[model samples]
Target: MLTNKGTLIPIGGNEDKGIEDNEQYTLEFIDDGILFHVVREAGGTDANIVVIPTASSIPVEVGENYLEAFSTLGCKNVTVLDIRSKEDSEKQASINLIKAANCIMFSGGDQSKITNKIGGTEIHDIIKYRYKNEKGFVVAGTSAGAMMMSQEMIAGGSATESFIKGAVKMYKGLGLVPGLIIDTHFIKRGRFGRISEAVAQFPQLIGIGLAEDTGMIIKNKRCRVIGSGMVIIFDGRRLKHNRHKILTEGTPMSLTGMRTHILSNSDSFHIEKKKVKILPIEAPFI
Candidate 1:
């Protein structure tokens, strides 16, 4: 399912941060930088940003980081929803915060933690509702947060180790978007093979590999790459052969004809059309 109502930003891990003079941890000082794209997508300085740190083990610390970052960005209404358990996820207060937020940002941590705690909860339902029905709403996440944005997510395993048949294990995600799987810290961690294996296994699903400091702004099933690095897309629709059906786990996989593309900043790709636009059309004549 795709919606043109809201924006979805899935950022790779290692976002900029710093420590304040007061000894409190916060994001690095910079005007309209770091999470500038996020702020802009959520209505800028006046945006009401809700930081969900459920995926992080250090929820309090991680939550504070986001709060400080958004606050420093001139977003007066910044809140951190530290959901540590399934019980906390279903709380009315939590649901209310999510419903009222202009943007919901999932912090970096364990993707499984988020799915296990918030999946199927009232808060989750509210998020889905706002994303589908409301306008100007934004959903953003980094690392594990990014991985969980799709219908199917890569739970674990590196590219090298998961090169064999059935070696890659995927888990159900938030399903904010379906028919795709996302992998973060891509190039730095050499995750191309992992995402490739995932595509080979599920040829119908598109695989996205996001490098650090890079991300994709997805709207209505169309994706635009952003940040300093690249977004690798593994399209397996032309897959000629894969012994996945007959091979067992750990067996060498034979995959062929998987088309791949590297998208840098400003590049856009249409999920349905499977086309890439390298440059934006500019206004002619002044």
Candidate 2:
């Protein structure tokens, strides 16, 4: 099933769930994509990694900061592409970066900007193609960067704000992972309500609320929590609602008998099964 918003509707079926129990989707979530996370994992070995910093709202310095961080990852050869500029120079640079990288990281910023800038661009297509061909490429993001991984993004704000109708105003995401709605800065920003609203709008989709400094490593349809925060899984597959007239914003709309699971770092959750496989800890690694 697919949502009206163009996101994959979470359905109960073999195909709907990415979990096969035997296979795992291998992905790494780093603080950023290059120097901090991917490079460290590389351990001085040369590996392809792409960095998308559109969410950073600044220029990514490849030689200055990125190189230094990448060295720690033991990467001898590194290429950094700053897609934020999207100028002719940057576009060409982005093409080269995507073509060479084994892993792609999307930085935190306004998701709308990131998607608009690179969604359908050549860079995006190249990365997708490479990843699909089993180049051992891992894609990751933080905050807004993470939001764009899902087919349906959480572009709407709180119910208190003016809602521009028409399926929550979503743009074309990178489509790295489908059928899931991802939100960042979850706990700190009190974004549960917003994700809940998204579920109400599309109950078929599983809502993943990731707290700051925390990330969910998705492999083979199952998610492993990694970071210092909590990940809230909102499963509305069994949601029930009452018909009412004249629904107003922030009127304490009641959702009777809705259940949510809170998972912390190193914990795991199954999207299709809608169940928590492990419990989270108080102290999670970054």
Candidate 3:
């Protein structure tokens, strides 16, 4: 129920940065890509955008990557907040950058690092405050950054575990969106079973599995899919039979009445309503 006024863009891993390893193609693919949408939603290229690469092990390289990507999108006012430790989150410099920014973009690496370093910090509080109260404030993240948006964060899991019990590991997140449990790299990484167990654990929350290069723009409890891949939604609230609680760890589990939705770019989903809204605004949403 912690729906906010600002926008939340949680992308699956491997988003188009518009750059290659050998400096091949730049700005050619990312024109209408995820970063373009991020810039557009953050009030365009002039918006004060701050990229936090705290989750990344190589913060400098990741930070520079975002700088170039945003630069290619015509974003003139982008800054990288290289937060490495918990102490860095409390610094006046970091707080100032967060306070002045219209959008905060989190880079992917380790989701736990974001919560460990910045969770409950001053800037974290400020972001939640602005996101809850402000209309245009944007909080966007990719991969691990995407997973940290949910209150119930997926820390780590065994992809090889299949649909077995205890395959997914979860932890506390930023609590920006309490209604969702987000997972990144769904199709490529084969995270269907991982998120399925996660939904069985917290049946009240909706499970969102975002594929590579895909993302969702969430506002006012409504989510619209973006990017090139798919977004798998698992609704477990109407579950009839759940064998997760009784099953032992590592055992295969069965869950009945777990509703699923496979949505692509331009498709829409109303979170509270649990209904899909396809393209064409003139037609019936449900």
Best by TM-score: 3
Q: Which ranges of candidate 3 are over 4 A from the true structure?
A: 16-32, 280-286
Ranking by TM-score: 3, 1, 2
Model 3 C-alpha lDDT per residue in residues 1-286, reported as the tens digit of each score: 6568899999887644434732222221254488888888999989999999888877887778778888877889999999888899999999999999999999888999999999999988999999999999999998899999999999999887869888888999998998899999899889889999999999999999999878999999999988888899999999999988888997888889999999988898998888997777665322
Write model 2 residue lDDT over 1-286, tens digit each, in one string.
Answer: 2112111111110110132322122122223332244344323266765555565545343223445445556666665566654463246766777777666666555788777777777877776675555424567666677788887887657533332223244555677666678877677667766777666666777888887656665655667776566788887767776221245544555455457888775688876666687753554444
- TM-score result, candidate 3: 0.92
Q: If both were scored by TM-score, which would come out higher, candidate 1 or candidate 3?
A: 3
lDDT agreement of model 3 with the native? 0.87
Q: Candidate 1 — worst ten consecutive residues by lDDT sum?
A: 23-32
Q: Write the per-residue lDDT of candidate 1 for residues 170-281, one digit (tens) a residue.
A: 8889988776789998988888778887787788888888887887788887888878778888899989987777887878777889988888887888878888877545
Off by over 4 Å in 2: 1-45, 61-68, 85-93, 159-169, 242-252, 279-286
Spell out the clash pairs found in candidate 3.
none
Alpha carbon lDDT of each predicted model? 0.80, 0.58, 0.87
- Residue 117, model 2: lDDT of 76
